[model samples]
Target: MTSFLDEFAQAPNLKYLNHAAVSPWPKRAALAASRFAEQNVLLGARDYPEWMGVEQRLRERLMRLLNAPSTDDIALVKNTSEALSFVAFGLDWQAGDQVIISDEEFPSNRVVWEALQPRGVEVIQVNLKGMDPESALLAACGPRTRLLSISSVQYVSGLRLDIERLGEGLRQRDVLFCVDAIQQLGALPFDAIAAQCDFAMADGHKWLLGPEGLGVFYCRAELREQLKLQEYGWHMLEHMGDYSRIEWQPARSARRFECGSPNMLGTMALEASLSLLEEVGMATVGKLIEERVLWLQEGLERLPGIQLHSPMNPARRAGIITFSLEGHDNQVVFDRLKAEQVVCVQRGGGIRLSPHFYTAPKVIEETLAVLHGLAG
Candidate 1:
């Protein structure tokens, strides 16, 4: 519907292009969160059942978003790091087992693997600067390699990997695959099933256009129980409501990973945000985002002393476009943009501009005009 595009009622002077970091929620999500707060203040937990319904819908939306087999494969976690820890600490690791990853991964992806070093598990950082990144990553999967962990799109450089290629290559080597999908999940179309990922996780606050502190984690069904439970509570019990029962086991579904009460406030907002994305359809969303990214790419390339750090190939990126001006320091440029009310971030040794599907053309034009002035 045409009305869906109007959901974002941002400031007229604001040129926000920082979805790769934290995004401002649309009007609908803000309203949903407001209404939820009112209900809590007036009625307390009296309508808790209805709140649970919203949570369920959130899981379903995430299930469809990830192309997961079922809602049973999805777990609402605190953030990407928590879900990564579930897989990092859950798996049984042996001495000399290697975990291969890219050299450009965010600290969240890299530090987790490196932590396993004390257990005699080596973390091999593979350079993806070569022509064929997938081949370089797979070549590192020697006989002792047990898993391959990578980000769907590198956060800083905005280099999108061929997940299908990596998935197939890892599968052939009998290696488990884990994807940190925070950068790609909401910017473009992603498939956990197609990628054959044993585990995948993403936070809601970034390109999902939702609030912080809530995220989704997907684990393949066959490997569900294989992950040893590190946390336990009433919520994760198979019989969650049996208050008087002593005997309990983890839920047979992915709910086993949820250790405590849900973040109901975050649930309401993210669910509403997801509804908007569903209405637009991810295919259309991806196309619109690519158009915007390409526009930024072209505009920045034409500016004097501009150099792009992100991939120039259309097929090799998502919504992010990182670039630098020859005469300007990254922090100084970032401060100038911030003072001008052009919301963007300095990352990957440059300024990272990420515009979403609903970003107005005027925003891009005006933001580029600012950069044009700075370039002069």
Candidate 2:
């Protein structure tokens, strides 16, 4: 039997630990994209309908990955930021309406809400430093609070939130819950229905191991039309292929959010990447990544002058682990690691390392060995 790790044949000496930012495509995904390009070059639009089948499959796969109620709930968007914009600008915000977010949000989650300030909507940044983060977020939701948009896993600190609890609480309070699931979708088992989220979005490039320009946006069935549509085109029309029709409305399905032609090239890669995930099984994938994170955490804990920034509890984290050296600046440590071909990032006041399920144990060992040399 062929080892699954062979699908990710990276440079022998390169220790890649930055899946949270962008992931290299699996061999299958790369081949899929290449084949797509070849088809485009040779036959052009002759096989376009077949390509649409791939796009449909991509939507179906995303629906399965998100545990969504139906494929009707999934919209193929350009990225997480664009999906967030759909929700931000779509809502009918009153002057006194309040939107609550966390202090540690990536600018995608924070800036969208902040942009609403011109509409007289107040954006509240809640501190998640307390023992009970869910409770703290819930407490911030008052009479005028309209919605709570949060990341399933904090991008910087690698703090995974109790999403089910927060979602249920917001549901009871009649508050809209939106999840920025870019970091969690492929790294952990995610369920939009179980979380009771009104909206959810994730980019395919991160943990999905797809290209950067394509992503999935999930809207609850009931709230689909409640969000005002900002863009329009033939694809988003109710009668999509009926070019001669004089009158038209947006699609009743989640397709309404997709204003223009789909990223067929990106679709080819993402569909192939997701097929790989389905084959591995998300449960198995999550377990492997957790093992890697625990291994990294244990190694870092034993090293001198290493200060952990991410949550220690296994239940409170996903694939990310971050730490800082006691005597070295974060940039200095990050540059040193980069110089050695340890592909990582400087984030959340420290050096952030994110390993996917396919990451080799040798990579983790080599990273620890490098840190050991730095300590000495």
Candidate 3:
């Protein structure tokens, strides 16, 4: 097993704090991708059986990472948005049916729900700013509430919702619980089975440290045939390789969501990347990321002009800490951080800094120092 530091061959000049967007691939993932490319160059589909094995491993890894009921519950989708769309459009919705969501959701989560408005489905946006956001969301769920679609950790604010409570609460109501877990999955321990959620989706590009085009969508085993298939192709059939078979139906598992050819290259990278996280263990990963985020939070709190947008409590946050200088434009702060090689982004009226578990302490310290110096 390679040491975590040995795995990250990132340059010293690059203080990467942008995992919320795309992530820097670790050495193992890069090597996996290179090996895949080499196989394509030399042997091509002659070794296609081996590729299926890799894809199966990716599914198993995602299943374990999500604490899903089985590997069959996982589907390798292109991204979170695609998976979200499958749910947004597939559900048997009636006119006036409501879907609950937070106001702070990323556009992917927001737009998909809003698109359903033409069908007479109403999108309910609840503010998560107050002390009792979960209660507020639950309260908003009335007779017509069909689903409560929410992000596990808010993108810009790093607000980690109590998914278990929300799931349990919605379970008794006739409302389905769907979690967009891109920001929380790899950064923390997320259990789909434990939460009793109907559906969950997450991209691998964030804390998972994989390529951008790959993600996992976990729909409960019993609910597989429930989501009506929008896209269809040969790949999703149960007898996919048996072209001679006359009987055809979408797969009984969550693989039915995969409508076409697989993203083999992305699967190779994500599988290898997950190898590193499994070795570190999710609990350790969560603890390490929490420390880094808290370090940033505390430093920003001490700064004269900086104001925090993320929660002050560690339990309420996953792996993001956002802040802004009192007098500067968001773009200006973003530009300064970029110029300094302290990679960050401007979001939710502030600068969002997301550091992974492997991020060194010095990088966080230096980034904060540079930010304070610039503000001063």
Candidate 4:
């Protein structure tokens, strides 16, 4: 069996447990970037076509990542924000059209929909604090609801939604389904086609272990034409290679979402990173991450004078567990963990710890030991 842990030779003091935020790139990904840099320094643009092949591989990898219907359904964008923006502003909004969203969405998901305010579109913030979160969201939908934009996993609470159920429910009502999958895409088995999702976007920086500037957008093949192109460039043209042609139009595929030059450097890193995921298999990746999460959850529950803020249900989680000590403030605990070489973050009401499949056991043990020391 190929051990994922064998590749990571980090510092003896380092305990990286924050994959939900910015992630540390793997050794192979780092080597890839270094090679790319070396190429740039040694001979710039000498093998540009080879780089384009890498970019195409990136699109193919993303198609596999989101289980998009085809490679034609994938677009390499700058980030998730730009993909969400394409769907937000490109849509022809009516005066009474309503966009449904959860109250716990990250600003990227919330702000884009809210930006449609001047176009007479209303963004509805649905409370997802009930026994059945999917049901709560489905119940909030009314006749005028045009689309439901949601995060597959809540950033703070780490509550994973049943996107398939949500998609089926919304599709029955003819509502568009857009999922911000940054927290769930690389962490779990995210299938956009299985969910019947109209749009899915995720940044590569977090769980994908890729660079910050590039991400993936998956638009359902049918919905590609529905969105009117807002941004245009020579690259997005159908006849991109034919510079002499006067008449041109945007690509009929998901490449229509791309408005500018491609990010080849980002493509190199993300493609190499995704190769690891494909080798391990996302189903196994999800199970291994769940195992780590369960270990942390069980350990956290046993600790005295601690409160678990993230959801307890295994059915509703991906790669995050959150907690707060009884008397300590979030920052104090965060700094203490930081000093101990535990890479975690302060989110929601407390500290958030997110570990990936290869997170060493000692990291969790040391984190609990630190918490135990704090409790005393």
- Which parts of model 3 are misplaced by more than 4 Å? none
Worst 10 residues of 3 by lDDT: 1-10
Candidate 4, after superposition: displacement of residue 274 in Å?
0.4
**TM-score of candidate 2 versus the correct structure, residues matched by position:** 0.99
Compared with the true structure, model 3 gives a TM-score of 0.98
Off by over 4 Å in 4: 1-3
Task: Give TM per candidate.
Answer: 0.98, 0.99, 0.98, 0.98
Per-residue error for 326 in candidate 3, Å, reads: 0.8
Per model, state how many residue pairs clash: 0, 0, 0, 0
- Candidate 2: misplaced stretches above 4 Å? none
The local distance difference test score of each candidate is: 0.94, 0.95, 0.91, 0.90
Q: What's the lDDT for residue 340 in model 3?
A: 81
Q: List the residue pairs that clash in candidate 3.
A: none
Compose the digit string of candidate 1's lDDT tens values, residues 202-287.
99999899999999999999999999889999999999988899999999999999999999999999999999999999999999
Return the clash pairs for model 1, or none: none
**lDDT tens digits by residue: candidate 2, 67-178:** 9999999999999999999999999999999999999999999999999999999999999988899999999999999999999999988899989999999999999999
